[model samples]
Target: MTLLAGGTDLMVDLNFGRKRPERVVAIDRVPELSHLEGNGHVRMGAGVTYTRMLAEDVGSAALREAARTVGSPQIRNAGTLGGNIATSSPAGDTLPVLAALDAVVVLRSKQGERRVPFAQFMTGPKKNVRRADELVVGAEWDDAGPAQTFMKVGTRNAMVIAIAGLALVVDRPRRRVGVGLGSCGPTILRAPQAEAFAAAIFEAHGWDRHLTPSDAELKEFGRLVATAARPIDDVRGTAAYRRHVLAVMGERALARVWSIT
Candidate 1:
């Protein structure tokens, strides 16, 4: 049996004969999965659509930007965040943002409900730890402040698949920086070295003040982020090109988050 929400991803699989499930459950109307709530830690229901994500205050700038870039307007209207998480695609625009924000995946089953950190949620491309009996209820994350942005490079300007994507978040209150890479790995990956380096710079310069790193520092941070990717040569692009895109995007995203010119 398969669970269906907006059917944005599942429909394509079905249309292409990639998925032939004996049973399909439609959960779009489930009240528990349609609500978006909380403040300190924003919780968005699985059934929440990308259109809603853009219109509502989800407490993550990166998430909003990611949502804005998903497919076309029609796709955004029908595509759900839970669907994106369930698909577990490395290029799912919101995945990198979720990773950067350290979001929690909320799941429910007959046994009970459990929350899994985003880092441990996805095992690989289109694979996750979700059990057959469980349903993805939503995702939750702390408010990382306004200093965040999402960037991606695609073959075209709009409605295109990302060759490489990056989401950068600056948690001023925690004095932490997070960088998440997408489409450049088997799964959404965080750049630990780049994060630590940026955090240290933030600490030294004072989080309360607007600070810009030197050109060398930014380049090094980008290099560290590119090093974290494990991309493979595919129809969309070459592994080398993906790494280069990541490096460039990582730098630009960080600069945008810091409001650097």
Candidate 2:
């Protein structure tokens, strides 16, 4: 059965004649799918809507920030994080955030439950590892208290898909850095080199909350992020444009997070 939650993705496909499913199962009312819990490590029900994410602390500031950029208010009220994960759109706003956070995706089926790292969950654009009989129950991650931010280059200020996007997470306590790329590759990608570069800077700066990275360091970090991206020209943007934007966004996001106390 085709799983249905917020119907934000599925309904669009239906309306556009892109999908014609013979049957669908509405999983939105499943109690287990609607709860959001935890602190040290957070669990967010797969059915959690973007509206709920913004309404409540969803464990990560990066997630909350990404949730706000999903779509218009009405769409946010209806779109579920599970749906986004399952849909596996390269442009899905929250996927990069989840990847950057290194979240775990909880998949359940009659066979049993299995946990997969977010990085391994999606194989390519609009493709994932979920079996036909399995359902996405929720996702979880250890809380990395960091100054985090999400930014995307869309055609408009709102209600638009990303041309190229990036999620920057600075876990000062752990002396770690994460960079998640969106709409710039076949799947959501993490910039390991950039992350390592930034983390080294954090280490050098003693992970100081008040520390501001030098302009040269930030530029180098951005360059690394851009280099990590494997983008293709699409209707939304050219590959070269995406690379340039990713670089700029990487530096911009890092700057914003660093400015936070």
Give the whole-model CA lDDT for all candidates, comma-separated: 0.90, 0.89
What C-alpha lDDT, on a 0 to 100 scale, does residue 215 get in candidate 1? 85
Off by over 4 Å in 2: 259-261
| lDDT over C-alpha atoms for residue 255 of model 2 | 87
lDDT of 2 by residue, 1-261 (tens): 688999999999999999999999898888879898877789999999999998646888888888888899999988998999999999999999988988899999999999999999999989999998888998998877758889999999899999988988887766778889999999999999999998887777778658777899889989999999999998999999999999899888888998565
| Cand. 1 TM to true fold | 0.97
Give the lowest summed-lDDT range of ten residues in model 1.
252-261
In order of appearance, the predictions have TM-scores of 0.97, 0.97
Candidate 2 vs. true structure, TM-score? 0.97
| Predicted model with the maximum lDDT | 1
**Hey, what RMSD does candidate 1 come out at?**
1.4
